[model samples]
Target chain A: EDQVTQSPEALRLQEGESSSLNCSYTVSGLRGLFWYRQDPGKGPEFLFTLYSAGEEKEKERLKATLTKKESFLHITAPKPEDSATYLCAVQAGAGANSKLTFGKGITLSVRP
Target chain B: EAGVTQFPSHSVIEKGQTVTLRCDPISGHDNLYWYRRVMGKEIKFLLHFVKESKQDESGMPNNRFLAERTGGTYSTLKVQPAELEDSGVYFCASSRSSNQPQHFGDGTRLSIL
Candidate 1:
């Protein structure tokens, strides 16, 4: 079964602090890796999709980078509004209906 | 776009009761998916629908759960005789295509006592 594991289950940072969250995975064949941000009592919002190793995507203060075995979500100069749960999911195989295997997620709390 | 929307933001019931959750995907989206997140656990896929067809349902836990996407516009998931373990947040998502990033609904929180 495809599996995704995220490190540092919970993180606390001061406003403007920078840090990175890690997601390690094992799959038969990788089709795509996705990053999502979820707020309390809300659904997850799309962030980035990294398809291959050495690929990276950036949005505002968030930058997502992918390697063969893992992915990283780097947050730079984060603000209190950036506080949310970061989810990492992997889609295995090239099939059109492939489902995503998600990690437990990392909860981030940025203090102002 | 309105994004994916789900009804009954929250529900509470005793085990063995029946509950039905509804979802309306983004207009024109052909792909719809169902997922659940148990407390302290990762979000897990339950099923997928492509234009009213069951594209994949490998993640469904058991026969007690049934899902349907009639007319390819809206979908519903019904859990009969729900167990206490079924307590969790059920989310619905949709995308333009399989390769596109899916947009999610706020989710229906179901608590089975």
Candidate 2:
């Protein structure tokens, strides 16, 4: 079974604090890893897609890096508006269904 | 272009009642997906539709849930005899291709009594 696990169920950070959210996965074969940001009462918004180990993508204050077994989403100098639940998901390449298996998400609270 | 849209931003109903959620995919998007997040849980896939045909429905919880994508433009998901466990946020997403990234809607929050 393909499973995705996220650590630090909840995190509180002060303004300008930097941290990383972890997403560990065990899949038959990873086709792609995805990162999404979800606010309360809203759906998830796409952030990045990592296809291979050593690959990294960045946007604004957020950066995403992928490894062979896990991925990290690093937030630099986060603000109150950046507070949201960060989700990680993995897709298996060999499956007839391309449905993604998602982590429970890390709830980030940035106090300003 | 407009993003995926879901109707009835929120719904409240009693157990055993029927509720229907609707989704409008982005123009030209061929792949539509349905997912839901139960309380304190991860988002789980419910189904996927390619045009007017269901590409996969393995994630569907049970026979009580029925989904349709008639005419290949809009889709609807109906839950009959809803259970208390069905209370959650239902999300709709669409992608131009099956392998590409998907765009999501604001989601509809369902509360069962």
Best-performing candidate as measured by lDDT:
1
- lDDT per residue for candidate 2 within B11-92, as digits (tens), equals 9999999999999999999889999999888899999999999989989999999999999999999999899999999999
**Candidate 2 whole-model C-alpha lDDT, 0 to 1:** 0.93
**Candidate 2 chain B worst ten-residue window by lDDT:** B95-104
Q: What DockQ, on C-alphas, does every prediction get?
A: 0.85, 0.76
Q: DockQ: which candidate is best?
A: 1
Model 1 chain B poorest 10 in a row by lDDT: B1-10
TM-score, cand. 1 vs. native: 0.98
The CAPRI-style docking tier of model 2 reads: medium
Q: CA shift at A44, candidate 2, in angstroms? A: 0.3
Model 2, runs deviating above 4 Å:
none
